[model samples]
Target: MLNIADVLHRWCRAARPFALATVVDVTGSTPLPIGTSVAVDEDGNAVGSISGGCVEGAVYELCRQVLRDGGAPQRAWFGYSDDDAFAVGLTCGGELDVLVQRIDPIRHPHLTFAFAEVADGRPVGVAQVVDGPEDVVGAMLSIVDDRVHGNAGSGPSSRAVADQAHALLRSGRTARVAIGGQADDCPQSLTVLVHVHAARPRLLIFGAVDFAASLSQVGHFLGYRVTVCDARPVFATAVPYADEVVVDWPHRYLEHTEVDDRTAMCVLTHDAKFDIPLLRLALDLPVGYVGAMGSRRTHQERLRLLTEAGLTQDRLMRLRSPIGLDLGARTPEETAVSITAEIIAHTNLGTGLPLSSTSGPIHRPAVREGAVMK
Candidate 1:
């Protein structure tokens, strides 16, 4: 799995065989999403987790069994059991369909290539036949951009599945795709799980202040490629946590940089001279998050300036002024946590309310069906 690509790459390079249990499907409430995986090596060492803790023990043993037998991939299901409290199931009242398979360079060279691509920070996707005829089961196809590698099968059905996988990969989704039940090209039905390992999203912080440094560290921990930018070279060079430090005007830098819907832009330069021009452009961009740090008074003044600068109410509404959730944070580190929390809440469509006050599934369906884009 991409979550433990480093571990998989290490084991692969050492010529170690391991069993991987991947969550291919789920029904009802579940803690972890589909595509979550758990891997176990021959020596009983393990990496990654399918469920947070509920079904891991059962999945671990399943991996061990697959490793011992070295057989075809096995599909196991786990669901809540009201009749038996001691049952190995999800207490949260959900069902998980996991596919456990033995992985080695000799048999699954495609997986080895996928793991290596993920480790090298290249975008790649692996489409595995989770449900199909016995001969097609566990077959995998790897896709990197337009090029397709490996083989799901040796027919038109494989080509059809690969086409779908390529589309899903471009959209950055890890989803189950079904094909070939009644089609003339293929009679047997096949269900493939397309798992994507895209590049990390960008988190651009414009300020180079202490708060920016702290936020940069948190953003990196959260798996974003963090960039700290400032007009002053002295401050920009001091931010040790950012992946890239740029000494340039915030607005100018943003104007030339690439951004997408998954990108998050934080304007920590509370000053009007920097915040005004930078935010004017940031608010118009279709980014995942655009938050500015300032006081209530500063927020009102900033809004007035933006309005005067021709930004409409709709664009202005997108700005999170006096940025960050209300955590009563005063220190830079605490403020960073608060800001990151708000960014996650916004990206995930969370209510920003305490979990105790809410009901229903704790982990909602992602904006994109299989993977959380932002």
Candidate 2:
């Protein structure tokens, strides 16, 4: 999803009337996932996307209606049917439930903080009373306590909603959740959409070679904070693909940096001075993926060197030497894709086979935390 901060803040600052639309829920396959949002202003200016193409036009009209009528918050369902009369529905045979509301920035002060949370790369949960009384229809707030943006509702309902929102945020997902429980009987069901925006993962490419250059671009496109580090100051002066270019020893740069389970380490530096020391440090770290680029003989020699340096077989196994899948890649760009594909597969726990050859769902749920840093 595009940054909501830019669109909403601009409109708010301009004092122009606008409507905010969000995909609250989705079932089966969908063009856009739930929690995707778009801001439609009074003059029909739109930013961000909900359903790429399928239900966008219909959603646009809903936004316009809210703008024309002045603050009419409503939930809409766009789906497919065999015997259909409506001209507007998803042709992909999926269902989408969207929540559209006229949000006055001047009136709803909390929305600014929610947009800021997304901009700052801090995770925030948005809990809205989707199905509720008229007074609380468009009531929504960011699930952050220290911030001025607080809960939307009052009483038992608000407490239950906060707990549910926190549980969903910890998993780092966006979905529709039901709150409110019973004491003696079947309690009321309040629907809240929990949208969590975690910071993008980091990808460190330790080389200024052709493959590293190409991989840097691909990593940025895949939503990673890309950094290209090399020992040669001239070679590492500037890499257009990477977000940052650092001229330092690969191992030294890594040691000074903060790497977590979401960090991806790509060691493209074939020289032993850079590769051996960096790979030794990388293999033991808790990173999402550790890769090194080299020929068969080069990799074997590197393995021997690593073993002499006190790396065990189990620790050495974590290194994907001669990195990337066997795609018969000839060019540096193609090799970059091969390596990127392998990293994505490792992160998602996929077999890296064609969807047609797979039996189960093509898009498996986010089963674990980015594939356990393995």
The best candidate by lDDT is: 1
Point out where model 2 deviates above 4 Å: 1-4, 68-72, 84-87, 116-125, 129-137, 143-148, 155-191, 232-234, 300-317, 355-374
| Candidate lDDT values, in order | 0.86, 0.77
Backbone clashes, each candidate: 0, 0
Per-model TM-score versus the true fold: 0.91, 0.79
Task: For residue 23, give model 1's deviation from the true position in Å.
Answer: 0.3
Quote the lDDT for 67 in model 1.
97
Assess candidate 1 and give its lDDT: 0.86
lDDT of 1 at 129: 90
Off-target runs (Cα >4 Å) in candidate 1 are: 180-188, 368-374
| TM-score of candidate 1 against the unseen true structure | 0.91
Error of 1 at 192 (Å): 2.1
TM-score for candidate 2, residues paired by index? 0.79
User: Which pairs of residues have clashing backbones in candidate 1?
Assistant: none
